[model samples]
Target: MALVKVQRAAQITLPRQIKDAAHLAEGDYLEAELTSEGILLRPVSIGSREPSPEQETEILAVVDQERKAYAAEHHR
Candidate 1:
């Protein structure tokens, strides 16, 4: 297995071997999940009209974060 480091801003650069084996390319999208073992990433195709479940989850997460931030700032 290849090893990778989480960089600043929580970004990770996939190793060349891993990218080649997975047929990943720039502009490709991946769905990330937390499993019992570790983080899981799977390549997914997104439709132009409909958002994938993973994307919806990500959107909700972002909305939740923004709402909390706004509430904190406005309340104080």
Candidate 2:
């Protein structure tokens, strides 16, 4: 497994090998989830229209909020 460091703001830089293997590029969208084993990351293709950076940030924020809510409900 490739090791990656979480930088400031909880950002991670994907290793070159992983990027090439996954065929990921700059501006590509990824869907992340908290799974039983660990965090899962998958590439997301939104048809032909790619969201702007601001939109992507907003989407991720909403996702994070939902994830936190779910975890809170289940962890009690």
Local lDDT at 53 for model 2: 82
Per-residue lDDT of candidate 1, residues 1-76 (tens digit): 8899976445689999989999988867678888999999998876643577898798779867866875787678
- Would you list the C-alpha lDDT of every candidate in the order shown? 0.79, 0.81
- Alpha carbon lDDT at 57, candidate 1: 91
Number of the top lDDT candidate:
2
Which digits, one per residue and each the tens of the lDDT, describe model 2 over residues 1-76? 9899976445699999989999998878778889999999998886544687888788889868876886787679
Give the 10-residue window scoring lowest on summed lDDT in candidate 2.
46-55
Clashing pairs in 2: none
Task: Give me candidate 1's TM-score against the actual structure.
Answer: 0.61
